[model samples]
Each structure stands twice: as structure tokens, then as C-alpha cells.
Target: MSGATGAAPSDNPQDGERGELSIPSRRPRRLRTTPAMRNFTAETDLNPRSFVLPMFVADGIAEPKPISSLPGVVQHTTDSLLRAVEEALAAGVGSIDLFGVPQEQTKDALGSAGIDPHGVLNRALADVRQRFGDDIVLMADTCLDEFTDHGHCGVLGQDRYGNQIVDNDATLTQYADMAVAQARAGAHVVSPSGMMDGQVRVIREALDAAGYADVSIMAYSAKYASAFYGPFREAVGSSLVGDRKTYQQDPRNRRESLLETELDVAEGADFVMVKPAMPYLDVLREVAAASPVPVAAYQVSGEYAMISAAAANGWIDGDAAILESLTSIRRAGADIVLTYWATHAAKLLRQGR
Candidate 1:
């Protein structure tokens, strides 16, 4: 039993090795002993290309003004927006999502300026496209909320008794017009964040009919009505007097997001997205798992504001937290993430993670 009677050398690869067994006491730590090893073994990697920067371009500001709620983020003028695009491209960010700030006087009940070719957003898109010349992906946010006087995602309606409600059919027509306008303005992708039913199909057909078949559609399929958008309303100068509860899904419902994603896919959406990425990683993961096209998640303004506020107060390391948060989003199965920290994150990523 001690010597000659011991089990014979096995034919298995492990047993046939001629050298002495070199198993380390600490197990898998051996593989992670060096930076090169750790990097090589990493299961998921995040890069600047995965991050999409969301920018707000105001109509009249000459100097970039910092958003009070979102530290380090700014409302840029058209000239500054182009400069920002150049900075983002230099930092390795490949995609940019644009939002425009309309003057208070321009916002109206119907948000008619949203589809106007000469409106703030449309004009800004044309300027950016002309300057960039397709070097980067220019994405337009196709939602009426920023342009609407009431701050609702769509045009509002009234019941027989004069109570306010969203007219789904009426909104779809508006979204279709908005989509075509954005496409014609040279947006590589038109992201419909209105959450209206059949919005994807309507916008897709509208773009195709208008000879913009080359433009892509990024649908905000599972955008939930969340309180995290507090800072965003301010950034866009929303004049909302009430909540969007009637049109937006309740936070209590999770399964509804899947249904929304399913409907969006069926409507020919090229990409499906879940908004407010941090708190809804489960929804993001679910959508990413089930979606046939690329899945994106939006790290909305509220998410950015809270983190920035905390970091500014000396509560946390800002740079570290930003990278970690973005990495977590990518790890949650989002192929692309629309984030306010995109340029900063890209700079950090390009500097070797």
C-alpha cells in the first residue's frame, strides 16, 4: 500500500506528467499573479466605443455653462457642441447622443418646433454632421419632452370632461415626422425615447418613405418613468406641472419591460434600450438577453447627478466610481451605454483602464 501496491500511474493527462505536481496552495490566484495575466483572463472588457456621450446644446449660450444638478456636465452652444464632439473623438468616444435646449417661449402645447427643420435640435444636428462628416455616429434623441411646453413625451389631449391624457395615435404621427426630420438632418441614428406604442414601426416606415432608409432606429423600448430624471428636466428646461404616470410604466412592473422589448423588436427596432441603467440592471440584463438586435442602456441624468454630488462632497473617489459604474453597466450585458460620463470614461479607458 505504501510503495509497490500504490495505484499505477494513470493514462490521464494530469497523471502522465513527468514533472512533480506543482499545484499552488492558493489555487486560481496563480493565474492572477500579474497584471498581464489578469487582463488576459478578464471575461468582460469595456472600451470607449461602448460608451455613447449625451450632450445638451443650448440655442444661445456662447460659453459652456455647467449644469447645476450634474457637476462637470454642461449645456453647450452650437459652436461648443461641435468642439465637444471633437474632444470626444479625440478621447476615443465613437458615439454621441444630442439633445437641444429650446427657449421657454419656443416650447408649446403641441411641441411643433420638435419637427421644424430650423429648430434648435435640427440645426445643431446639421452643424455637427457637416463638421464631423460621418467620422463619428451622430445620434438624435427623438422625443418631444424637451421641446414640449408641458414636458410630456408626446402631445397631450383632453377627455370629454377636459381632463388631460396622452393621445397615442396622435403622438405616433408626430414621432414619425420627428424621425424623418432627424434623419434628413443627418443623424446616423434616431433614438425614439417617447415610449409610444408602435413608435418604431411608424418611424421606420416614415424614414423609409422619406428616402432615409439608411438611418438606424434606436428604440427606448423599456424606458420606465422614473424619478431619476429630476436633473434632466432642469437640463432641458422642462415646464412640466405634473408627472408622466399615465403614459410611463409603473416601477412595480418588471415583466412589462420584456413585453415592451418584444413589441419593439417586432416593430423592426434596430436596437432596444432600458433607461436609468444603474437601478434597472436586471431589466437591462433581461432585455439584452432576449433582444435580437444590439442592446443599449441609458445612465440617465439623475444617476449622474447623485454620483457627482456625492463625489464632490468628498464622499467618494469620482474617477474611480465613474469607471466602476460604467464597467458594471457593460458587465450587465449592455452592448452600448448612453452616459453623461462617456468622454471622461473614454479618457480613462484610453489611458489603460
Candidate 2:
């Protein structure tokens, strides 16, 4: 008898009487034989409910302004922002993380507009709540940089030596006030992205004191001072002249992320996040492992711009790249992902792509 490949039968009886080869015991490829099989065996699935869209709402704009560096993203006017939120809801995005870009005139050293009940951010929160009515989660960015003239995340002060620096304790006070304002304005979650120490605790206490104990806090626990935030600065019209290394985590450190996660969790963060997700998946994994609460990762502006630029130049499949990048972040154990592609990715997931 011949084998299935039509090989001639072995002449010697000792050479496997039927001229058959031994079958391998292990065949991992069997599970990957088809799309259905692959889908069934996927360890990490990207769910639409796990996506959070980061939106920029320019306070005084009459129309949406495109961000040049971050292609396909824009600084939205209030009306435009509401439309975008509606679109996101239709596309099944789980939440919208709002960042307000007040006009330059509204900025001040203290970023007092951030705590004003009628500030752009707070009004946007009110508008979304009125429109959506709990149909989708509304998250507010509780930070001072977007509202401050100096573009630092906190108030500035001088040490006894007269060296200027961000005042962490002062920043915490601002964050607490901002949290209360956001909660009052109907934010389901207030994400403190200033990277200030003890911020989560202060915000938590403030929310509790204000009878908003239900409002969640998502701490930017391991936000690295990365170059990836360049486009974000532009998108928010930041006037920052110097780096945030004094506060934001150093990109070179690994174990430090775990420590930050531990601190945020201890400080009563409902969720902890890692910024610039792609560049810091290792940190995300470590933080996710150590965090008792949900872990989120922000796919920052640079990551989006890089992928968008490459796709425009015909260097990569844009859709595939976006999906792959998000999948990688999810695989790294991010419970939620804040990405510009949240709406598009959610639609694709609905289509089972």
C-alpha cells in the first residue's frame, strides 16, 4: 500500500509494514485552521463596552477645528462635540472622556475656570447628561493644564531657594474642587490626569463630602512624561513651555509603575490608568496585575498620529493597524482603552471583524 502522498510502499516489512509515517502527537495548528476556530480560541477579545473615546471640546469655537498632527481628530465646538457623542453612542462606544479647551482669554495661573460650574467642561457634562440620560458613561478630565495659562497640570510656586515648581498639594486642592464640580455637572467618572500625588484620595474625599460618593475616580497613576503627548498639547491648545518630568512618571522606569499603581489604589482610585499605552505595555501589564480595580490605558495622540500618517502614505493598512494596536493594548490586560479610534473600532467589533 502507498501512503496518502502516493509514496511507493517500503519493500522491507520492518519499514512500517503499511509504509505509513508516524503521526505527530501535538498539532497546535489544528486550532488555527479556520477563522471560526481562531475566533473561538482568542484569549483576548476587544469589546465595544471596553472602549472610551477621548474628546476635545474647544470652549468658544463656532465649528470643529481639525488637529493637523492628529489626523481625523479635531477640537470640537459644543454643538460638534454633542454630535460626536451621539455618533459615538450609535457606534456603541462605552464612554466619552471629555477634555475642555477654554479660549486663551479664559486661562489663568490658577485655572479657576476648571472649578466653575458654567465652565466649558462642566457645561458639556450637563449637556451630555441631558441628551444621553445615562445611556452612555460620561467622563470628565479633572486637570488644570488645559485651563491654565502656564499649561502645567497644577499651580506653580517657588521653593525656599526660589526655584519655581508645581505645587503638588495645591494641585490636589484644585483636583478636589474640580471633582466636585464635575460630579455636580453629571460626570459619571472624573479622571484626574495631573499625576499629582494623593490626588485620588483628595478627590475621593471631596466627592464623598459633596454627597457624590457614587462618582468614580480614574487616576492617571503611571502617566509618563512622553513625547507622545505633543499632538495632545496642540489639540488642547496648551501653552506649556517646559516638560512635565517634575510630575509625570519617567518613561525609563518599570517597577515605578507598579508603585504608582499601588499608591493610586491605596489612595482610593476606582480605576488606575497608564498613559501612552503602546509605548508602555510592559508598565500597563505590571500595573494591571497589581491593581485591584479596573486598569485603563490611553492610546495617546502620538500613537494615533503615527498610525494615521503611515496609512496616509500607503505604508500600512490603516484599519488593520488600528485594530491590531487596540488588540495589543487589550491583550496587555487593559480593562478599558481610551483611544481616538474608539468609535470606529467599536463599529468593527459589532460587525465581527
Candidate 3:
């Protein structure tokens, strides 16, 4: 048989009729053909300055203690914390958020250590300020959960029916006091993560009254009561028994987040944020769209642990996943991202650029 006689017809009927090949006129692939082209055409660009590193400083620790669930993360001693801050500064991270881990024996019902001048968080703030002197934006987690033995984020009381409940007004008083304490300790920002109603207004008033008008309040405006916070409990050494569904936003509701965001913005939150960023990207997008203030998203402990664990198992490209996750949050409208991988991600972004 002759080869030409057995040849197949053109896949396109028109091509066979005209004896011509079909080609696409518009080629989006041209833009993606080269790495340089992809970088130039990139819609969302990440910068190290947009990352905020969340750190833990433990009181009365002779050495840094590793949190098993958090893998590379640890509860730093005062000495180690200063070193870590140096690394973060060198990495060009935008900020560092400090969480105090009081010794178990020191925890109490009222979480008084949070307001004490010599409190672990306050002392860590002072030390970081004395060393860095505003080289970085220092933020304090102004919540009572880590310091309170009961592990609720606020003061507790009994309802008329004899059920224990977090007293909203009383907790606001404690939060106001805590904000002032954090301000005095050299925090540039006091972040109220307790998800209390009217917390932003109360904290703002207290900070201004204490001559800390310059201190900014970053409200945990749309924090959801998520199980994604599992590793955070370990990171902060929390004593929580029950869930915080009573105070934190319900994961199923989006409208409530917008309302909370609006209230926080009206009350003087310099920044408002959505917690457990990956799980609440939709909420973050809506909040970012409606709020006039800057919006932040937190890649919480569980999110980090999942990625880290998978990476360890050789199931995913760790660096790529980290960047992708961060980019997703940024694309969803977060001006800042509070993440455990902040320093590492900062370095990754620099290397990539």
C-alpha cells in the first residue's frame, strides 16, 4: 500500500478542505511563556512588609520550649525572644504580635497577669521596644485566655439561671485595662482578640484616657470559633475547656461578620481582621470590601500545622504551598496577614523576587 493513500484526513474538516492548519489568533499563553513575563503580568504581588509574625513569650522559662503540635514553632524565653525579634527584623517582616504564656501556677480566674506591669507579655513588650526602638511595629494580643486559668477570653459570671457566662461589660473593663497596660509596655498596637461586643470602643477610650492616643487598636472583628485554633492552644498553653462559640462569630454566618466589622470600624479599630484565613476567605473578602479601615487575615495554628504536616510527609511542596496560601489571602483582600510562617514566608518572597 502507498503511504500517501493510507494517510489520515485533517482533524478539522475545514483544514482538509483548504489544505491548511488551524491556529489560535489570541494566545494568553504568550504572557505565561516565560517566568519574567509571568512576574511582570502578575496581578497580585506579595511583599515581606505585609507579614506579621505571631510569637509566644513564656514567663519564667529557663529555655525555649518547643510546641509539639506546631513543629518548628516554640515558646521563647525572654533571651530567645529578643534573638527571634532580631531575625524577624532582619527578614523585613512588617510586625510581630506578642502572646504571653504565663506559668500554670500564675493563672487565675481574673487573668490579672495580663494587666500587671510585670506581666510576661508586658515585660516582653518593654524588652523588645528597648532593643528595637520602633524598628518594627510591635503588637500585643490583648486577650485574657492565655492568662486566665478558666481559659475563657473574659471574666466569668453566673446568669440568673445559674449558668456560668462571660460577663460582657465586666470583661470590657478588663480589656480596657489590658489595652492601657499593653500601651504602657511599648506596644504600637493593642489587638483585642476576645471578640467581645463594644470592645473596640471601650479599648480606644481607655487607651486615649491613658495618654496612649497614638496606640492603634487592631480588632479581631470577624474571628470565628474555629477548631483550626487547635495548635494555637498549644502555642499559648491555653486552659480552655469549652468552646468560644458564645462570643466568637459562627463559622456558618457571613452577615454577622459584616456587622461586626462595621461596628469595629465605627468604634475606632485601626485595623480589622478575619481569623483562620483559609477557612474564612469569603468572609474576609466581604469584610474587606465593606470596611473603610485596613483589613487583616490570620492563618491560624491549624492551617499552619496541616501544611507543615503534609510537607513533612513529602506530599506537597512546602515553600510553594506557603506562598500560595499567603497569596490566596492577599488576593482575597487582606492588607496584612498574621501567620506563624511570617518570617519564613518573608524570606521566601525575597528569594522569589
Candidate 4:
């Protein structure tokens, strides 16, 4: 018989000798034994305000066009874009990052449409600002790839060897102009994702000179040239022949991200972002730790498409995966997460699933 009158005898001789084989004093599973306990003990939490939805608005489209690579995402027409923004706002999404897909005929060597006040992107920005009236943050993509025929982020030039190269200085000029235009169109923030040198400083000066000193700059400081951007090319209808290895950071370098982050901060960036969040969470965590300004992580289109595709095939739980992915990003020290799943994830968070 055991010490307690009602207890049964030990099964093992060792248990009888050692007073029922001394139990562990520490049991980590105690905290995880119940849902409420797990929730209460969670180290990181997700909130709708921490999410930013990336939306693509296409010119010359009467209806929204589905992006084949990105299952639930679409290139929105002006009307549909506004409706989507409304839905996102209703879901408590904090911001919308707008990318413009101009008509193919409008693309040019200099990507002039990017800086045009009457461009599709500027028009959409104006419409959204007028409708929402600062109820939501309006962020515009300050890159030229969507408006350039070559689908490069900057203007192309020939070197002495006749090799085509992206002119970094020339692209800075265009980025400055586009920043002013976006600010004029009522963009609350302009995100420069081109990864050009001196871009943030030039845009800041231009914005101040153009009397848009109030507009914020979100720098893609640690953006890497990654395979994760494959689906985004389809979403934006890119016509690229080569890569952006010269401008975008190399994926192998960890120290380079800190250099980029420091440069952006020194150059007047209000926020800094790391691209392809999951793959670069290590970089993101380091950047977030070092950056004085807020840090954002982009859960790029490829990340979205992979989980979405797997979920559609019944290989994984879509809802749980989305939450877990976003939570991981948050845990990695991102203050804001830019994702296509923002609205859906926000709804799930509200439902406490």
C-alpha cells in the first residue's frame, strides 16, 4: 500500500523503494495544458493594427484580374481597389501599401508614369484619401519597376562595354520625383523598394523642397534579391529579362543588412523594412534590434502562394498556418508585417481562432 490509505501499491520494486519514483519538480507542460493558460503565457501576440495589406491596382482594367500565381490575390481596378480598401479598413487593417500596374503601352525607359500626377497610382491614392479621409494609412510604392518597360527598378544605361546597367544616380532622381508626386496625391507614406543608393536622402530632400515634409518615408533597407519575389512579378505584370543583383542585397550577407539599415536611418527614413520575412527573419530580428525607427517585414507573394497552395490541397490548415506564420514574423521582432493575408488574418485574430 502507498502512503495514502486509498492509493494502490506501486507496480515496480524501485517505485516502492523510492516513494513512487519521485516526480519532476518542474513541468513545462503545466502552462501548456490548457488553451487559456497557453494564451496567457504567449510571449508574442498579433494585432490587426500591426498588419499592412499590399494591394495592386491596375490601369485599363474594368474588373479585378486574378493573379494566377497568387491564388486569392488580384490586380484591382480603381473601383474594386477602393472596395478592397474599405474591406481591409473594416477588418481593422492598419494600412494599405499600393502598387500600380499601368497599361503596357504606358511603360517607358524612364518610367515617367511613376512621377506623373495623373498616373494610375496617383489617381488611386487621391481617390482613397478623399474617400477615407485619414481613417486608414495610405502608403504608395515609390518604385519604377511597374512603370518601366524593362521591369527594372531604375533607368537603364549602357557602360563602356555596352552592357546595360541600372543608373543608380538617375534612379534616385526619379525616386525623388515620384516621392513628391505621391505626397502631392495624399499618400501618407511613400515606400521606396528600389534598393538604390542615396534614394532615401534624395527623396527626403525632394519631399521637403516640394512642401511635403509631413509625408513619411518607408525604406526597403534590407530588401534581398530572393526567389520569393516570383509570384510578385506576376502580380505586378513585370517584364524583366534579368535580375536586380546589383541593387538588392545579396541573401548570403548578414552584416550587409545592418549597413543598409544604418544608411537608411542616416538618410532620413522614417521606417525600415526587410523583404521575404520568413526567409530573412534572422536579418529582420537583427535589423529590428538595431533600428531606431519602426521595423517592418514583408511576407512577400511567394510566401503567401506557398502556404495558400498547400492549404488548398488539404495538406495544411490554412487558418492556423496563416496565424502561425504572422505570429512568427511578429516574434522575429517586426513591428509591422506587410502581407497579402492581412485582412483574412485580422478576421481570424478577431475571432480568436
Candidate 5:
């Protein structure tokens, strides 16, 4: 029966002599086949209006001082700050985040200058508001790190062991006062970047009681104690003697971001932000999904400087990298992006290049 053979094999016509057909059915590149198609089908869009530029204003400077670590960024005098704002407006960027560089003499235990009506930040806010005339969204950085002598985000006190610890509750009072001062100075939004517990709620109450119910609060919901912030310390002349590990989140933790975001949302934050965006895209996505308000991501100084440094060395194409990084942040669910490249990016976006 085996020798009889059950059947005869026949050559298939489709295979021909090569035993293969050259039809390509799985063409993923069809979606990207043309520039028009690519542009039309882009999942995320980056625009100048969605960007907020962070600016530094020093108290007594007659001229803008360049920050060496953050190339193209500067600590501006009040006049220079106004000029920068004008440039930002012309570029179609409608928002600016202001950080004040106070004189070293004014720093103290309670950061009392933070609440002073005549303080650096307060004065700068007034100047910007008056100069811009409500055309721009003026945001004030509501944190004590720049104002405190000890350079902790909160008030410092001695523990039982006599080691210095941040006095969180006491600091909340100072934050509330600062919030009021910023609002009085005409800030459209007061951003609490201190990562202190109950800060949003405290600031909200203070603003409302002071008849500043219109002012918004942006909370730094998940700020990690990352080494990436080194350039930022230099930009603001931060006097921090020790790491913020005791207060800021550990870089190793992922779930903590959600917890912090949830707390900020419940505490009356008008918006929640993920700082140092490049390193925490997962956290940004999770927080964005859970937030009822808008989500913002800060492409910090280190992120900008690194890219610029690499671009300068010809290691990467700066233009492509900048757009790609910003697009990634937007795709990850950030409605707003704060970056040192805001003005340049805005100009590029406007030119349709």
C-alpha cells in the first residue's frame, strides 16, 4: 500500500518557479506616504499659544544677567522683564511664569519677604500686569525656596535631635500670605510649587478671603527631588544647603504621582503640573487622566540646556528634537507646556516651518 502512493504532487501556478508571490499587503507606511497625510493625521499638535515661558526677575538689577547653566535664559531687571513680555506677546505666547530673585539681605527664617507687598516678586508682578494690561496670563511662582534663607520650601525648625526639619503647617500660613500678596500684585494665576500638604486649599481660601476669587491656582502636584534641577538652582540662585529629598518625591516612586495629583485636585487646584516632564511621562499621563482640570508639564532648565548643549556639539538636530520633545509632552496629555524654548518654539510654529 505504501508503494502504490496515495496521491501525486502538482506544481502550484501562483508560486511559478520562484515559489513566491511579491504582493505586499501589510503596508504601515501608507499612513505616512505624504506630507499632507502626515500633517492631517498627527495625533498631537504643538502650538505657540499652549506654551508658557518662565522668566526670572531680579530686584535691583539695571540689566539682564545671563544664567550660564541655562543658555539663552536670564535674570531680568524690571525693565528687561517688561521687554521680554512684549516679545512673548508678539510671538503669540500668551502666558508667562514669573520667578523673583530677591536680594540676599531679605531672606529670613519665616521668609517674611515672601508676603511683603514691596518684595521683589510682588513688585515685578505689578509691573508686568500694568504693562501687559491683561492681554497675557501672568503667573507667579508661589514658593518659599527663593525667599527663605535656609532654602527649604517651608519654614524650618529644630527636631528633637536638633536637626532642621521643614515646619509644614507654619509654612502653609506663609504660603497663604504669599498667595494673597501675589493676587494683590495682579497675578492672574498663583502657582504653588512648594509641594507642601494642604497648600492649594490654604492659598485658595486666602485668595477668596482677600477678594481675589478670580485668580487661579496651579499646583505642582508631583515634583521629584531629581538632580536634573541643578541648572534651575543656578538660574534662581537657590541657596539650598541640602537636598529636597525630605519633601520632594523620590525618583524611584511612580504611584506617588497619582496620589499627589489626586490630593491637589481635591484641594481646589485650578490646574495640576508635572515638573521635569521628560523624566516623568508616565506620571504625566496618569495625572492627566485623573485630573479634572488642565494638566501642565514643565520642560525644565536642565532639559533645555542638555538639548542645546548637544545641538551645539552637533550631536543632534536641535529643531527636530525640540519639536519632538514638545510633541511627546502634548501626546502624553499635557494641555500646557512650560519651557525655556517657548519663544523660539512659538516663532518657529508661527512661521509654519
Candidate 6:
């Protein structure tokens, strides 16, 4: 019988041993029912377009040499690099940041080879530009660490107390030349990753003066001095005996990133980046929110190495972890992610996995 209020009557105890259940009126699980639904509801635009593959091209290598530290990644010869680029393009990765591994014999204190037109990096840039034209966004690593025998980002000098230090002012001159050379070789973007102060202004002025006014600058605005760069050191064959704590940001500082980012943007950086993305997602988030231009994060070599090793040991699902890592970075607000797994992840995304 209905009451005066006309509400439904409660269930009789005779219907079941358990009386009545209280169901939630606001169930959030409605959106979690299917993979299609989840994908449709995804907040972040995680796709192939978000990745920027970082590739290494070595000088004087007859064959592609595998990097033991970075599993499944190789230092490609010019021919192998083209093939790799083709594969990346086929997989829907449209951008690549190139790093050149020069021969040890070419190393010099001033890293003058980095500015030479025939240097390994410039040669690869020219070749890729010629082969692909505007089919891809070619980025060059505009730093001297790889070319300098001392393994510092800049030329070394002594402080008043005779303590060896990076010559920040001298390095800017080198960076200006390096940026122009990369631009001449047809790099669409030149990334100044040495963490030198005023680098963005110097490079911008140089690029404009050289008539490559359209070339973009991707400044490493919040690069940290993390120990996680060990694998990258091996990949680039760095010859440093000490650390780069002097230039790179300290891991302990969070607000420091905003300061660095503000300066880069003010100095005309087209894009600013945070290195070793996973460990510094907080910093990435802050920079992304504050920056006027697009922000990028690097999924550095050590991050890749640890994940690959754990996956190889059957500790985790490699494919899922890769996507999750990238997704996490995207969620943290990075517009572009520089990863070693760009091509592989692109393929997986196409497969809808």
C-alpha cells in the first residue's frame, strides 16, 4: 500500500536473508565501464604528436652501435639514421632531436668542432634537412659537452681563488656560433641545454643576425643536476671527472624553476624545457603553468634504463609502463615529451593499446 507521501515501500525481509542495500546515487564508475569510454573521457591529449624522439648519430662508425646503457637504442650511422628516421616517420613520430657523438680525436678545449660546418652534428643536420625538407622538425643539441674533451658544457677557467669553473661568458660566444651553425645546417630548432645564464638572448640575437630569424630556440630552462644522467654520459662518451653542479639546477630547489623559466621566456625562448621529467614533474607543472610558450620535458636515459631493466626481469609490463610514464608526463602539463621510446610508443598508440 502506498503512503500519503506516495513513496515506494521498503523491501520485505521475507524476500532475502539480507534486508536492503543502500546503493550510491552518485556513482562515478559509469565512465569506467569500457576502454572506449575511458579513452573518450581522457583529459590529456596523449598521442603520437606529443613525442619528440631523441636520436644519437655518431661520427666514423661503420655500423650502428647499440648503447648498453640504453637498451634498444643505438648510435646510428648516417645511413642507419636515415632508415631510423624513416621508421619513426612511418610510426607517426614527426619530430626528432639529434645529438652527435664525435670521435675522441676531434675533442678540443674550446669545442670548436661543434661550430664547424663539417662537424658530425652539422653534417647530420644538413643531411636530414636535405632528405626530409619540411617533412620533419629537426632539432639540434646546441651544447659543447660532447665536443669538448674536458666534458664540461663550457670552456673551463679559474676563479679568483684558482678554482676551476665553467666560463659562462665565453660559453655564450660559443653557443651563439653553435646555434647559427645548426641553423645554417637547417635545424628547425636549436636547444641550448648547457644551463648557461643569458644563453637564450645570445642565441636569439645570433640567429636573427644570421638571417635565420624563424629558427626557434628550445631553452633548457629548468635542467637539474641529477645523478640520473649517468646513462646519457655513457651514450655521449663524456670525459668529465667531476660533476656539473655549478651550472645545472640543484634538485632541492622548486621555486628556482620559475625564475629560470621567466628569464628564458623574457629572453625569447620559443619553448622551455625541464630535464629528467619523472623526478621533477612538480617543477614541470609549475613551469608549464607559468610559461607563455610550449613547455617540454625530457624522459631522460636513466629513467628509461631503470624501467627497461625492470621490465626485462618480468617485474612489470613494459608496454603499459611506457604509456603510463608518457601519460603521467602529459598529465603533469608538458606539451612535448622528449623520449627514447617515441617511435615504439607511437606504434602502440596506433594499435590503441
How do all models score by TM-score?
A: 0.91, 0.93, 0.94, 0.94, 0.93, 0.94
TM-score of 1: 0.91
> Per-residue alpha-carbon lDDT of model 4 for 274-296, expressed as tens digits?
99899999999999999999999
What TM value does model 4 have?
0.94
lDDT of 1 by residue, 112-210 (tens): 788999999999999999999789999999999988888888988887899888888899999999999998999999999988889999999999999
Q: Which residue pairs does candidate 1 place in steric collision?
A: none
For candidate 5, the TM-score is 0.93
Q: lDDT per residue, candidate 2, 272-335, as tens digits?
A: 9999899999888888888889999999999999999999999999999999999999999899
Q: What is the C-alpha lDDT of each candidate?
A: 0.89, 0.92, 0.93, 0.94, 0.90, 0.93
Which residue ranges in model 4 land beyond 4 Å of their true spot?
1-20
Residues 119-143 of candidate 3 have per-residue lDDT tens digits of: 9999999999999988999999999
lDDT digits (tens) for residues 1-353 of candidate 5:
12257645542224546667666677667789888988888888988889999999987688999999888899999889999999999998969999988889999878887889899999999999998878999999999999888888999887789997997889899999999999999999999998888999999999999999999999999999887888889877788897888889999998999999889889899999998899999999988888899999999988998999999899999988998899999999999999999899998888775
